[model samples]
Target chain A: MTGRVIVITSGKGGVGKTTTSANIGTALAKNGASVVLIDTDIGLRNLDLLLGLENRIVYTLVDVVEERCKLKQALVKDKKNPNLCLLAAAQTRDKSAVDADQLKTICEQLQEDFDFVLVDCPAGIEEGFKTAISGASEAIVVTTPEMSAVRDADRIIGLLEAKEEIKSYRLLVNRVRPNLVQTNDMMSVDDVVEILSCDLIGIIPEDTGIITSTNRGEPIVNDENSPAGKAYINVAKRINGEEVPFLDINEPKGFDAFLAKVKTFFGIKG
Target chain B: MELNKRFIVDLSQAKTPADIVFEVSNILENPEAANRKIWLKLGDVSLNQSQILSIKSLISSINSTLSLIESECSQTELAAATLGINTKDVEEELQAELSTLEAESPKDTPSEQYIPLVDYKEEEPKESEHEQQENKEILDENKQQQEEIENKQDEQTTQNTEEQPAVSSDINQEENKKDEEIQNQLDSIFDSEVKLENILADDKDITEMQNWPLTKEAEDDFEIPEEIMTDEDYAILQMNTQYHKQTVRSGQVIQSNGNVVIIGDCHPGCEIHAAGDITVWGVLGGIAHAGCKGNTKAKIRALTLNAIQLRIADSYARRPDHIKNIYVEKSNTFTPEEARFVNGSIVILKVNDR
Candidate 1:
């Protein structure tokens, strides 16, 4: 079956682009859809580590493009899920190793076998980012709820709109802290979407579990209890063409409200 | 006063004189058996005076003296007595020794006191002054030792006749317990010394195994070209070595026609390629490719071989995923390692091993 190619990109670095790609890909694979995650961030790849398939990678995307190894030989299977695979980037070579046409060709060949092809794009609008987007028909622009990130997201959206190959693009505002938003300390999800005038696919809360999960090289979506994991699962469901409602991140939970009341009773500003 | 230590070599299982000599020589190979008093415990093997003299000389060769011999054979006991080696009952002598040590140190447990039989050399310098003084007094009590031995012998004879079966069974149980304790003590001592030798032996075995080259001539699926090199090619590679004395950071690439040597850390994301060998004097945390030009004899050596990927010839190996440390913490101590292509796989070894 022909697969839909989607690129996960963020113009600014460290905006959870790799984390989003890993979680969404894992969530989709766990739903029984065969998914392949391609990390195009050559020379500084982290997607293999996130999927815990770093050691399993022998050949990579550059090896496939250079004809050093076959395309099938470079696909490293996930440790836990047979339905998931990873086409890692070459840690020794830079973006010049594989061009845009070569990536598009690889993606086309992979589309015949898998149900979804998720390309984890590098942090920039340079040649690396261009080559990553060349193979995708859909885009997910991840951004934190901050002015700089939103501004970068706007630029990325503009670039995606200009590219005819990217038929659809959506916004995923990550690291949205509800308490900080309620206290007017951080930008709200609505503000980020309104500024960019883009439809929101997901709003992930700031969860400290993400750090430990990243270090452990496991996707946060594997953890069923984490709020960020639930959000990512919901995003995956939306991508599967299911109408899932957004999480009520704006509302303070019962425990949080109780803690705030206790603080106010202790003569502290809540 | 320094207490004279006694090491017991139990050869009761040896059936012949040859077996006894072989076992004694093997035990003496351990440096711990040197320069101490040795007590030989032989089972039913008969020996003459000349045989006992040879054994005594063998013990003395390592600066050790054969102070005592306990033999169940009358001929062996006669020969040992003629040789002036104290012929004593091992069980009675052991009882006396334990009583003396316990009287000197009342706070030690039975197992701790038992350690002196095999662990005296290592524990000597740590002896307390009060313990030394007690040892001196115990050594000077020759009359008391003679009296204690006579008293124990009398008690043994009476108990043996009164409860013959029970006494035999008790002796069997105590002998088994003592054997296990000695075995454990000897294992602990040999483990530290034998570990390096085991690793070196393993390295030798791996090197001796036939290693087929993995170039394109090997019918490999990878598209690496086969370039056969002669001995002269390797000599040229050894001559044309390049040395860099700086930290190789991320995104940097170092390529050489022959060998490449980096005197600093090679951080992750950096690449080092050489036709021959790649040596890193510091931590290697990047991708290192030796034999990039299809020389199967190329090798990679590093102070800390933490490279994300190591490539020798056409064979490559990635760092196992269980190694979670993406960043190798800089430290003063390092275990240098060398990686070479062996039997179509990359094998790493400690550098200090021959």
Candidate 2:
């Protein structure tokens, strides 16, 4: 079966593009789908580190593309999930070493063996960004609730819209502080959605578990207790065409809480 | 010709067609100047179509009997004498003046106006004057400084023309080098996989996979027309009120050339634009643009209308600052509301029980 190639990209740096990619890929793999996570950041590679496969990386994407090693030899199988694999980026090579067409060829080959190929894109609207998203049929733009991140996400959306290969893209609002959003200190999900005018695939609340998991080279989606983990699992379900309503992150007050409870009890589905 | 003083009314120095007519009419108005030989110097300036027609009529009225010099060279006595035009009186004065000025200045004579219909540099002198004023202050000491600035500009313009070809060729070389590097990079990366993929695909049952839009090339060949008229399209166009039962999620868009009715709420970032009325059974936190096809009579109705913006035809209304505060305070249960185009603006009113 030809797998769907998806790319996770954020135009701005430090907005959890790599983290979202790892988590979503892991979540998809946990559901018994054979998934390949390709780190396309090249010189600034971090997907391997995030997957805890950094020590196991003997050959990387550069080696596979350059024909120094076979595609199967380069794929590092995950210890956590047997179906999940990591194709690490070469820290020695720059973005230009692998062009878009090359990446497309690699992804096309990967799609034949795996059920899904998720690419972790680099930051900025540069050559690396182009190479990362070249072969993807679907895109998940990760953005924070900050105005700068939202604005950059808009630009990334505009770029994605220009691509002929990318059929559709959904926004993943990451690191959202529900408290700040309610207090109006930060932009709410509604504000972000209004500005970007894109479908909200998932809202991942701010969780310190993500950082701890990243430090241990384990994805946050492994833990079933964390809100961020549940959100990601929900995102994966949504990606797999499940109809799941968004969870209420903020504590609804008084009449609002009663209204919300009624809506939930009835499964209003709006 | 009973000559007193030969008044050369320079048409080239005139700012416009009206200026030329005015200058010539002023000289002609004097009874003494009228009787004298009014030498009309066409100079190097060419008149446009409209200006030529206006000036021709103006000149005809100024002097019925006038001697015309076809070229700027004919304005001189030596050139006029050679052409067999009488210049015996002006000939001696022109020779002495030309010799003395010839040493200090190379002939600053105006060039030939071969294409009189195209030349429109009559306002050039005025433009130059404006440029000079901008370069330096008009203070007593800066008059000479202004002239020097103007002279420097003339030198720079000439230098720019001479160096332009060299600069352009350098840029072209740099661009070509960049293109070659990119070509080399692409050749190195894609040279192997592309050939292997082609061979592998050839080995497969071509006819069995032929129907599928599998390859990127095949997908590209599959074109969807900008406007597709399906059974749904036809039905939507014919219906007065098209009903949609699904909630329009963020990033989703629903458009209709006819009236639309959404049975669910419109979330933020969801947009519903229609040519006619739009009615929502639930809340509308999104944007609803009714009368999108310029039908001003269209209206929008919803159970809860706290949308970010509402548009009817050419007019629109954003959620006001006060409305946001009100929404924050009382957002639990919204009263059913209707929005319409009234007095060139979108007006929303609460719907009472009827």
Candidate 3:
């Protein structure tokens, strides 16, 4: 069976689009589903590094688009998870090297063997954004609580709605500081949903474990104790169409701490 | 046509394009009117390409329709006029054909009718004594009903558009039936002579057709205003400064070519670019670029200059690492500062230092 091609995009830069793509793809693959993450950023390649497959990348997305290598050859299998793989981007070349039609053909080929194909899009609404989203049927817009990221995400949603290929979309607010949101200093999750007007798939709070994992070139989903890691695992469960209630970001930590330990015992986080 | 159904403009008496436009505008301004279609009886009048286009644009602006009737001119020439082409070049091509047309038509009729030299003298009235009195009474009653129907119809049309905008074709069909019913009732009342008149001032009604010089002067009168491309600067230098009182949120960009003063904070990820000096009375947390037009002399002043980036003309600076430490170590020690270009580099200094 063919997989669903999903594009993860945010119009503004410095938001966690690559981080979200890496975590979500890993979370899906950890559940015994075959998943492939395509890094389409071209000149600014980071998704492979986030998944700790940077040095192992011998064939890139541009190589596949140029017919220099077969699509299967370009895909590098994750060392830890056999069901998860990554197609790295070319750091030397720019986005103009790959057109929208070429990417569409590559995605169609990749979807046949994978259960979930997540395309990590670039930052802006320029050529790179168009090339990354041209093949996807579903979109997940990542936005921070800041006004700049939210406004840019709104602009991206408008562009996605205009495209006939995109059938549906949902929002994921990354890098949320629960303490700041609770004290009224920062924008809350409800405030973001009111403005964006989209189904919120998940909310990943600010955690020091995310930075520690990214620096070490390891996916945070491997750490069961981390709250950010648990959030990603839950997001994967929700994506499977299991009516999973969201993590109570504002609720007292008594139940969440107990449940996170229960999940650790069950070996849900890999 | 029914007398009360359509407005009439007998082009036989109109001498110039300007005179026809003037008459039509007058009739359209009246509140009580029947149909928007103006029946132009071109029995003895001839129009060039420019005159037809000018009349068409005028009627279109008032949301009215024009239907032409030809009696003297050949059907081919009438069709060519209504085709809406700029035929100044082709007018010279048709000069020979028009000369033959002039040879066959009435001798007293002028060959050219577009000259700006017009005579504004009154002509004899067309209404008969008995018909004029009967038309006046019927017109008064018809106008009252017209006003009432127009007000009710305006509200109904707005409601229809708001409720079922997708069914506009159905609304058009219903309106056409209502118009036919109204026309039949008016036709039975004024069955004789209730013609729409000149609808013009007495002076404009009698503009002499013979006063026009029938030469290259017609082209001079038809210099289309739309073709002129000269750019005119109508801006007045009234205010050299702008003040905004509301907070500028993230991703919002505010720019000006003059000095700007803001009473609220500029949040992160937002940008403000100005050509002149910028003064922020509140916290400045975003990117502020002054001297946008390469005016290095411009300065940016803020009560709390906590911006991510600052640029004055060609020089630029980002928030230094030490500044972040200052916020953490001794946040209360921070003071109001203004940034300016000093020797091709942007430097922030305390406001009291200046």
Q: Is candidate 1 or candidate 2 better by lDDT?
A: 1
Write the candidate numbers in order of decreasing lDDT.
1, 2, 3
Candidate 2 iRMSD in angstroms: 22.3
Which one is best on DockQ? 1
Interface RMSD of each: 7.5, 22.3, 28.4
lDDT of 2 at A99: 93
For model 1, what fraction of the real interface contacts is kept? 0.44
lDDT of 3 by residue, A1-270 (tens): 899999999999988999999999999999999999999998777897677665345458998888876788678777688789899887657899999999999999989999999999999999999999999999999999999999999999999999999999999989888778867899998999999999999999888998878876778998977888988898888888878877767743567767877888998872
Per model, how much of the real contact set is kept? 0.44, 0.00, 0.00
The A-chain TM-scores of all the candidates are 0.94, 0.93, 0.92
For all candidates in order, the CA lDDT equals 0.75, 0.66, 0.65
Question: Per-prediction RMSD in angstroms?
Answer: 16.0, 26.4, 31.3
- Name the TM-score of candidate 3: 0.41
Model-by-model DockQ, in order: 0.23, 0.03, 0.01
Model 2 chain B scores worst on lDDT over the 10 consecutive residues at B191-200
lDDT of 3 at A251: 41
Write out the backbone clash pairs for model 2.
A198-B251
* Candidate 3, B141-228: lDDT as tens digits: 4454345434644433233111111211212344344444443332232222211111111121112111211111112222111211
